[model samples]
Target chain A: MTTSREIRLKSRPVGLPQASNFELATVDLPAPGPDEVQVRNLWMSVDPYMRGRMYDRPSYVPPFQLGQALQGGAVGEVVASNDPDFKPGDIVSSMFGWREYYNASPKALAAGGLGAITKLDTHGIPPQAFLGVVGMPGLTAYVGLLRIAALKDGDVVFVSAAAGAVGSVVCQIAKLKGHTVIGSAGGPEKVAFLKSIGVDHVIDYKATPDVVAELAKVAPKGIDVYFENVGGVHLEAAINSARPFARFALCGMISQYNETGKPEGPPNIIQAVGKSLRLEGFIVSNHVDMFPQFAKDMAEWIKAGKITWKETVEEGVERAPDAFVKLFTGENLGKMLVKLA
Target chain B: MTTSREIRLKSRPVGLPQASNFELATVDLPAPGPDEVQVRNLWMSVDPYMRGRMYDRPSYVPPFQLGQALQGGAVGEVVASNDPDFKPGDIVSSMFGWREYYNASPKALAAGGLGAITKLDTHGIPPQAFLGVVGMPGLTAYVGLLRIAALKDGDVVFVSAAAGAVGSVVCQIAKLKGHTVIGSAGGPEKVAFLKSIGVDHVIDYKATPDVVAELAKVAPKGIDVYFENVGGVHLEAAINSARPFARFALCGMISQYNETGKPEGPPNIIQAVGKSLRLEGFIVSNHVDMFPQFAKDMAEWIKAGKITWKETVEEGVERAPDAFVKLFTGENLGKMLVKLA
Candidate 1:
């Protein structure tokens, strides 16, 4: 029997997720059925949004099925194929969950559209980027910035979680379009990291007490677009810095995700009406048509050495739970990825 | 010397204005300095927006000048004139501040714009209609309801301060456009008034403990457009009932004007982002082009008896301030006007 290491939900945790919230287990890979294929996961992605999945609550998508493997977008190779479309040695991607090996069928991830059995074409680019810079997180930043925020050239942009996967790319893309981009991270190192990647300005919220006053110092003209990756006080600062008719793109609210109780809401919504602002919430799946175009543009930027990124790779599949929990405490330097060996 | 009574701003009041705020003083008439005409005021209009004039703050319009007469649009007759454009005994509307008799010059209220001197036309409509049904209040309601709210033919519309001047016309216009209109007022009397004006639903917020729940019962489709006149709780309830992509026309927030302190803001502004709602603020001056069109439509609606309204006329200029205060307490019905004899 082939052995596979996996991380499973131990118990639904309240507030911040800790070590005891996750449990590691070993399981045998089942023989593939007529239409199923066996996937051997190589690279697994860990994201802040996964914290929402850990809890048993309704969101845009369903919560994690407790005692089941924690699933996420994964890049892997098919070990054996029973389906005619997918053959052995074909590189594929699926929400394969947090496991080293699994028996997956077309019904598991692909239900006819951009299905689970995607042909991973490296096209000479780094493959890990598909999990971060060019995958869901990348598209999240790109689609939200362009469609929802209506980003224009020379417009100023501010992103929360500025050094994180999606936020870092948002800063770079806004910069490529000739807009001034500012980013905020919790500590000094990440702030420096964002600055190194050509971010026009960086503010470590730990050092700045008054976000509105601080943003005024950086973007005296006020923010034209706000890429919201974190919510709460950061949201208030962004809202206050917004000029008339400014657009805000809501991708995620990481700050409120781990809270045990309901967090305080913004009380200055009248400013939105006064400033004639528009704030829109969006999901990456809604804009799938732009992927082919995005892949082309991003590939060119990478070739010209204009685009760069960093990934904090946690070694071993058994340590995946540790890597997932480290994201909450800001231990991640860039896109946090778990490499299965 | 000609005798003309006026309410002069002797001093700015600390809070809710009192008699001490005004000084009724008569001075010798200064003869028309070139291009000036003397007006014998026939009727004056009292409005809620006038409250902004009482404060010393920067707003869309300049605040009332201290130690000077309160300025507003007044309908009167040009009793004496030296300008070639005007003749004696010609009825005109001028921004002739708070006084029974005043002089208008080329450099008057608007200096070089429409407000300098507006000759009243009797297009089979009463001159008083210029202040009520077809004037600033009516125009405000029309512009806000149509341009900002974009009220659809079958859309459900909820207007606050339904018994007030602007809101009364909004409901009539909305009803004529085939909308299921709902309105909120303070008491049963005003509730019945809304029903008389063809509002499909009326909620007496005074009788209901939970306005959001009451609105849910009456407006099953959820409010598509909210014509916000009195803000505060009504605004909160509107936010709760706001349909996805709902439109809010924030014309005024009279409910918070006389508040002892800053009124607590709405609790569910994030719902705006969640539902992709659009809230816009507007003034009638921005939509002056609609006058000739509104003049025709309003006249047609009035002739067909499809639109009806109410006005609480306070006779004598001395009662104008009292009538103005009545609005804050929801005491007056329909448009509030002052008749000078």
Candidate 2:
């Protein structure tokens, strides 16, 4: 027996989510039971932090339950093996996404250390780029710009979803470390895909009428490293274009992920105490100890082409709730995936 | 020649500063102008971070200028010295505060190293407790709780103007480091002076209408060191009662420092990214290297009585703008001086 179809959750989103709040269903596996491991899925992921596991509260993971089967980040393969660390065609990666097939018990798919299961090598890359650029949004833009905004040397960074997928790997790692990068995003094709990567300054927060005066007319001697993926008014334009001691790095906000209520924060958050600012907030599974030096500096910055990525996909598994309602309608630009073979 | 009088800034406030925006003037002091010293004033400080140097813009200290003379934290005595490291009477301490004395030049009052005019060994305490609790609101509550909320060890904390003067020494140093604090302020005499110091939950934010459901009903196992001094809605009840890796610190906000406009922040500031929190923002002269371990642990926590302080004065130099507008009507509770003798 084999079956599998999955999807579930059929009701939880109270804000911007509705593909009838999902529900595909079908299941039936069988033969594997001892130390299990069946697998199948191919590519899954569709973030915006799964809208905070559809809100039943108490966060930092655990919440998505309802009719079940929703988890995320996928990339599979194994197809039967009594699990001697996976076998039949290997290729792992889990969190056990909105299914297509699953069996588990490889220690329950490697219990939550970056949602474990782990087995892919993909040195040639593209195993759905391990559910996005070197995975988990390139270790969340390398642990929020080198260990939560500690990225020094002339920091001027600023990011705010600069063309998605962990703000396009934090605008190509703050333009490959030479710093000075700014990038907000919304239209004009994610502002020409953040000026085709070298970013240097690209607002277009939907043709700005004031993203804090277009980030003070292009960071006039300010910003010292924000990152924060799109919170309200881009976190009040990075606390009104900070400078003295600025740091930020909050990571994900996706504009209040469909706020039903409490969502109007950042009115110059008291210019973070006259600009001593720090901010922080993080969670890429609490920095999976920077995954083997973020898989060796993202495989040498994607083989020296200095990293680049973008994927919208949405092919099967019932278009995975239309690729998570096109990540709250910015209509996906950098990594939204679904494929699910 | 000497005649002092001072005060100044007769025009700059637009929001809550009315006392016709201050002014008194008189001037006419000129004695030791060479390696100067002179002093005289007796106890000044009137802070809610001196309403952020009466806002004119560029912050972290410089602003209050208008017609001049308004720097803060005083406590004088020297009365003439031409400097060989002060002598006349010594007892110093100075930001050259708002009036009655002046001579300067100890390298321009120690060039902004904690508003320099040093010389004060008030070890037996009270020379205005070096301008409130061993100075600079007790080193801004010991560098915002042991170095910007790095407090740890079963942390709980909370704070928010817990009866002022650097939140009553950050609620007795998080209840003498045993933790579980809470505090908030306003009314019922600063909630019975934070239940006479041993605070382990006090709140009263103007008899709560719902300070995030009264900080989730007195931190039901939440807060892990907030201390943010009263920003709107107490920074939305410390980001809705943070917990997971919480931290905060952010020294002052005095409820948005008499907001003339841009305020409204902290509507659950995106629960600081699912509670990984951190916040930060500080400025005790950028941690004057924790001022000799905060004046030797605040003189052994005020000589083992485990710390306690409250002032409110307002005697002369013409009620120093009514002690800086009774610190915006919460009507001063702990350290709000003025005596200027």
Candidate 3:
């Protein structure tokens, strides 16, 4: 028997969840049974989507149950394995997060199963990348750009929240594809980070009094594609700067996720008709079929020094809630993660 | 030297356009020059989109100039022709509407040119059908469903403004393709018309207090495709009733067009991400390449009695402004037209 430290949902949040809404719990773990593998989680992800799960409402994914351990993407080492497919010391990724340890049966690791566990090759890259750039966030950027937006060469692409995990990758990928990339971030630091990754133009939304006018000044020809992560004013600005027939890949509306009341939608959505725009909202899990291709491309890009990543990591499982709360405040530079023992 | 009665835009409208904003004028008809044709318009269409043209804003189509004759889809008889391809007494369609007569040069009739004139065979169908069911509105419905929505068999479709020009055709096509169709229109008369056209379910939005709840009760399985014509609450309700991966073909947003201030956007647009919804806004003129195929399919459908059309036509060009204004108040059924002598 072993004791595992896990984060449990104390209650559903009203708005921006406080640390008190979550409780650190000590859970007793049993020995791995037949066809089961015991994992010691090393790194876990804290994403904006987690905010939606905190609410007891229907979303793309199920809401996090009260008094239960929260689940997310995590990379871990198999400490004990009764299954022949997984051996001790093997690195793997699973959807058993916000906890230090977990036991998964083969059924749980099977294709299309809950808590999908996959053995990681690592390939000299950090295992933590599986939680961000080399994993879900990376695949999201790839599918949203190539499949959803149908991004083409010479297309002027605008990415909101360009300092975030998915947006950063989107910026780099569009630039690599010979498209002019415009990135927007909250502060000068994030804006500078965006420029460091070879973004054509970076808008410090914190300093800009009018984002829409600033976008017009920077992209005079109007953007052909908008990678929407931050909605509200960013969405309105993108719509205003969108050329006729522009495509918008709607991944998230992080800006309004924490609002207690119904957030005001972009008032200029009517411009979509006049501009002949296509705005498609998608969940990353729907495009998992592109994982292999995305992994291959991303790996090559990393090796060629064509892609770079940043991580604002909180040390220890106890800080998971703090790390998650920071995402809403735009405190994280890129992928936000919590390291665990 | 015949005289032509033409409707001119006297001034731009501030809110819902008044009849005073338009004026009727008589102009001398010039004889056909080299490679030209003189047409006496028999029928002209006054559509909702013409309102956008009245505003001096850049859109998919150019805005209507003040103190000049308004242009739209019109079918007429070529009284005289200097071009070999077009002969006298031949029925032709042109974008020279709100007028009793027009002279079109070869430059004006050239492929892809503004005010392009095309010879219409009619094929035993009413000549006025060229302005609605067999023309732009028909193609709008076709492209919106097939190409934009990528509709499949067994897909449940919900059409807003379902008794109107494009929506009526959309409902019929979906039903013909063996898909369940839910239609929403204001008033009992329009609702009855939807049922006559074989719509599986009809919602009289005028009587319904909460359209979203009504849609949920009718389409318990949720809709797979939404043909969006009326926006506002209808759009919000459609999004709420949409199943995962649902497609929305945004043909028009007639509800908010005449609003003096910015129209309120659907507050539930966030549902799009969780449902993986795709909302594509399109203008029919961009997909004119599908005309031949649409015309062929539409002709066959009409011949086999698989399709039917209704027109709420106002007689005389003098009432064209009134006919156009009626669209805002939902005063007409199916295709709204102005019959010219």
Candidate 4:
């Protein structure tokens, strides 16, 4: 038997979630049944998107249920297996996060899901990297940039939340493609990180009184592609700074995730008609067909030292809530992870 | 020599345009230059989009200059021609409206413009129809629906300004394509007009206090396509009623055009991320290439009695300012035009 410590939703958050809204609970796990594989989680991810699921509202993904263990992307090792597909010592990834151990049929876990349980071919990369770069987050950046935005040659790219997992990857990819990249993030650390990744211009949104003016100052000619992660002022700024026929990939509006009341949208959205802008929102799961190509490209990039990632780790399952809440508070620099084992 | 009476932009409008912002002036039209044609305007259009030119900001089209005649779509009869491409009494269309008569080179008038001078076939249709249904407004509806919105099978279309030129066409096209269409406009006349055009559902936005709630009440299943001509509450309503992967064709923001100060945008725009919505803005000028296809389809539709139009005409060039101002006050229905010579 294995004793798994998992976080459960104590209550729904009204605005910004607090750690008290979650509770750490212990569960005893039995031996794997027929066709089931037992896993012991090593790392788990906490993303801004998860905040939407906490609302108990209808969305692309189902809302997280109360009194149940919160689920997310997790990389783990097989402890034991009754399924031929998974053997002991094999590394796997699943949606069985916020917990230390789990037992489920491999087929059942793989059913119609982006976070399907599958044995990892790490290829010398860290297993936790699957939780951020080279995994869902990496594919998100790729699809949003190359597909949604339809990035073309000579396009000037702008990304919000530049130091976050997806934004950082977007910055590096656009820079690698020989395009001028402008990045916006909160503080000095994120600004430095963006600069380190060769971002042509960095705007510390926290320091800038008006993001619209700052973006205009940096991109006097205006941007051609916008990767929208942070909404509100960032969205307004993008609309203001966009050149004719600019494309915006609406990845996530992290800034609006915690709002208790309806958030005000970009006031200058009227400019879209005159500017011929296209803003398209997407869920990464819908573009899983691009995973193989994304993985191949990402592998080559990593091998050539063209890619890098950052992680802010919380060392235990109990700290998972803190890790998640930190995302809203801007306490994490890049990917926020819970080291579960 | 011919005498031409034209409306000039005496001053840029601060808010909703007033008669004082425009002035009627007279000029003597000299003989046609080497390649020029002399023409007298028969019917000139006063559209909502013309309001954008009154601002001194850079846009897809140049801003209207102070003391210069305002330009728009006009149908005219050739009085004289210097080029072999045209002859006397031939009906032509040009971007030389708000004036009774003018002389210009056909080459110069057609230079890099959608509002270029071209002889109209009329196809047994009326000359005034060239300023509306078979012209720029009709093409605007065609491109916005088929191209920008990328309408597919079973899309429930929601259009704001449903009684307006572009929107009325959008409603008819969607209905003809076998989709359920919900139209929103102000007053009883527009509601009756929408029903006459076979719109499945109609919401009188002026009578409906909460547009979002009204949309939900009308389209309980949510909408897959939104033809956005009005911004503000209509945008919010569309966002609220959007189904997953809904597409919005941002044609114009008539509601925001007359605002002297910054206007508040849709408060629920952040919902776009979760709904996987796509909002694309377009200018008909940019999609001029589709004119031939649109013309063919429109001719067929008109012949089969599948299409119809309404016009609110003001007599004489002196009433042009009143006609233009009526757009903001929602006094004009469908195509608003001024009858000249």
Candidate 5:
């Protein structure tokens, strides 16, 4: 018998969740049943969607139960296994919770849990990269930009949360595609990080009094595809800057995730009619076909040194709660990682 | 030479326009210049879009001149022609104003003016029908419902302003394609008209307090395609009823046309993102290929007596202003028409 360190839901948060919303505890672990793999988690992914899991309301996925161990995407090594597909010593990733160890079911990723996807290939890149540039959010940016936005070369792209895991990848993809990429972030550091990734224009809406005026100067031709990672004021700004036939790809509403039940109604969709615009919302899991392509291309990009990434590591499973809370405040940069023994 | 009776703009209204906003006067017809055609107007279409012309702001089409004659689709016999494609006594339709006669420049309609497209056959259908049921609004319904919405047969369709010019035709087309069609109208009379055209379900939202609840009873599966001819409360209701992958074809915002500038925003577009919906706004003019197909199918529907239509005809060019305002009040049973000499 072994004990798995876990962080459970302690309280429902009002705004950007704090450490008080979670509780770090230990639970007795049962040995792996047949067709199950026992994993010793090394790193966990901190994402915006976790905010929804704490609420009781019906969302894309089920809400986490109070005092129950919360689960999401985590990279771990198989300490023991009874499954034919998974063997001991193999590094596997689970869309499971903030636990130091977990017993992952043999089923496909879809049935595993929230944010669960197909088995990821950690061939050329570091295992923690699966939590950052090679994981769900990265694939999300790729599919949302290339397929959903139907982005064309020279098309202008405007991404919200420009230095975020998904937004950072969106900026790089936009740059690689030869498009004029502009982004908005909270502070000077995040804005500077966006510029570091080859973003053509970065606006620290905090420093810039008029976001519209700044975007207008950088993107005189206007935005073609707006990759919306953050909602609220950023969305309002994108709406004002959108060009004719502009497309707003609704990927994440990170800014509005803390709202009681759904975000407040937007002021004008009627503008869509006049501009002949197309606004579509998409879930990353819906684009299943793109996974193989994402893997191949991402692997190639990493091998060719075409891409570089970062991880904000929080040591020990007890620190997972703090790492998760800091995600909302721009406290941690790049992909926030929770490392465990 | 007879003076043409024309309706010119007098003042822009604050909300719903009134008769005082128009100035009807008789003016001498100018002789046709080179590449010009003089047409004795037969039928001029007075549509909901004319309300936008009353404002000075830019729209998909140019704003209606404050002191100049407001124009729309009109079919008439050419009295004289200096252009090669048009001849005297030939039936032609172009962007002619509310007048008994108009001298149109080829530059007004570039390429070939009224002569560029096929003349109205008006065989099985009435010539006035060419201004409506088989005309601009019909094609608007077609493209918005079919091409942009990418409708699949048997999909549930919900239409707002269900008995108006555009909604009336859209319901019938959806029904013919084996779809379950639902509609919401202002009053019992209009709701009855919606059912007469083969809509499966009807909700008089003005009579029903909760639109979402009312739609929920009938559309347990939720709405797949929302043909939005009206926006506002109806738009909010549609968002709540929208199924995953719902498509909202925004052919018009007749609900907001009376406003001088940008209309107030609908409160439910954020739901559009949550539900993974696509909202597309377009004008029928952009989907021109549907014309020949529309002419063929509409003629067949007329010949087989597959269609029954109602017209609120305001006699003469003088009554165009009242007729236009009556539309905003839902006074018309089907299409609001203005007949000219």
Candidate 6:
């Protein structure tokens, strides 16, 4: 038997979750059963969407149950294997995060199968890239801009949270596609990071009294596509600056996720009709069919040094909750992750 | 020479427009200039979208300027013609309404041409049918549902303002396409009109205290397509009861158009992310390509008794402003028009 440290939900969060809401518990792990392999988690992802799962309400994914170990995307290595498909030392990705180690079945690893468990082919790139740039975040950016927004050549693209995982990739992709990319970030540091990624215009929203005015100054003709990450003021700004027939891919609304009361939606949503705008909200899992193409393109981009990434990682499983809370506070410049042994 | 009685914008309205905001002016009109025809206005159409044009802000169509003649869809008789293409007694449609007479240039009559003037065949239907069932409002309903919403067979559709010009046609088309249709109207009279037109379920919003709860009770499976006409509470209710991957075609928001201050948007718009909903706003003028097919199909539908329309007409050009205001008050059941001699 082996010991595994895991984070369990102590209770549903009311607003911004407290560290006390999560309980660190140690559990005994037995040897893998038939067709199962034991995985030792190396790195786990902490995303804004996880905050929704902390609530007791229904969402695209099921809410995390109280007193149970929380689940998320994690990169791990097979420490022991009883399954022919997975051998010891093989690196894989799974939805078994918040735990130091767990047993995974091979049947669960198959495409469209049970739990998400796929073997990693790092190709000289770090395995954690599979958790951000070449993973769900990257695919989300690709699908949102190309598919949902129906981006075309010479399109003016505006992305909120542009230094973060998905927005960073979106900015880079739009630039590569010969489109003008405008990005918004919180502070001077993130604004500088966005400029490094080739964003045409970067707005430091924290410094700007009126983001809409700043956006209007940069995009005089107006934006064709808006990648909506931070909602509330960002949404209103985008709406005010959007050109006729503009498409907005509603990716995440991290701004209002922690609000206990119902947050007021964008007051100028009526502009949608006058401007003939399209706003679509989506969950990445529903568009998994595009993952293969996304993975191939992302790997090629990284290999050619056309793509760059950053990760704000906390050491040890005990700091997982801290990493997650930092996402809301805008403390992370890019993908927020927890490193585990 | 002719004396033409026209309505001009006296001032920009603050909330609901009053008679003081409009002026009745008598102007002396010259005979048709070269390549021009003098048209005597017969029937003028007043729609919900006209309210948007009343604002000074830019929209899909240019805002109606103060002290200028208000323009909209109008059908008239060519009283005199200098152009060979048009002759005396020729019935034509023009974008010069709220007036008794106007000089139309032949260059303005071509498809994809400026000024939007077209000769009418009538096809055994009333020429005013070109204004409602077979014209812009009809095409608005057709494109919004089939094109924007991308309605498919077996889908459940919920239409707000189900007894109004566009909404009435939308309900009928959805039913004819083998989809379940739910309709909402203000009064029992309008609610009965919805049932008469074969709507599967009808909600009298005026009678219901909680529209969301009432919608859930009727559409237990939830709606797949939502044709949004009224905004505010209706939009909130639709968002609450929308099924996963639902599409909303925002046609109008007559409810909030008269608000002096910013109206609160749908509080539950966050449900959009979880449900993967798409909300698209559109203008009928932007979709004129579908008019031919729409006109053809709509005429056939009406001829076969598969479709029907009602117009609440107020006699004389003097009642034009009254007809437009009646739209906001829900006094008109279907298409609101003013018959001008």
Name the top lDDT candidate: 4
Query: For residues A136-215, what per-residue lDDT tens digits would candidate 1 score against the true structure?
Result: 78888889898888898768999999999999889989888888899999788898898888898899988898876788
Give every collision pair in model 1.
A71-A97
Q: Residue A43 deviation, candidate 1, in Å?
A: 4.0
DockQ of each: 0.29, 0.30, 0.73, 0.89, 0.55, 0.82
TM-score of each: 0.83, 0.38, 0.98, 0.99, 0.93, 0.98
Candidate 4, residues A1-341: lDDT per residue as tens digits? 99999999989998999877899999999999999999999999999999988988888888999999999999999999998878899999998999999998988767766867889999999999999999899999999999999999999999999899899999999999999999999999899988998999999999999999999999999999999999999999999999999999999998888887878889999999999999999999999999999999999999999999999999999999989999988888878899987
**Who is ahead in lDDT, 2 or 5?**
2
lDDT for residue A209 in candidate 4, whole number 0-100: 98
TM-score for chain A, prediction 2? 0.38
lDDT per residue for candidate 3 within A111-188, as digits (tens), equals 763258889999999999999999999989999999999998778999999999999999999988888999999998
Q: What is the per-residue lDDT of model 5 for residues B1-341, given as tens digits with 9 covering 90 to 100?
A: 65888988889877998888899988987688888888888887778877776778767677877888888777788888898877888776676748789887655566643234335556646777777788887878888888989899668999998888888888888887889999988888888788778899999987898887888888998999999878877787788889989999987777887665655465556666667899887867677877789878877776776666778888899988888888888888778877787
Query: Which candidate tops DockQ?
Result: 4
Cα misplacement distance, residue A28 of candidate 3 (Å): 2.0
Model 4 docking category: high
Q: Which prediction has the highest TM-score against the true structure?
A: 4
**Given the true complex, what DockQ would model 1 score?**
0.29
Every prediction: chain A TM-score: 0.95, 0.38, 0.98, 0.99, 0.93, 0.98
Instruction: Please identify which of the two predictions, 2 or 5, would achieve the higher TM-score against the true structure.
Output: 5
**lDDT, candidate 6, at A175:** 89
Over 4 Å off in model 6, which ranges? A109-114, B111-114
Q: How well does candidate 5 reproduce the true complex, by DockQ?
A: 0.55
* Predicted candidate 6 versus true structure: per-residue lDDT over A89-141, tens digit per residue: 99999889999999878675675531567888888878888889998899999
Q: If you assessed candidate 6 against the hidden native complex, which CAPRI class would it receive? A: high
Tens-digit lDDT string for candidate 2 (A142-168): 898888888889888888878888888
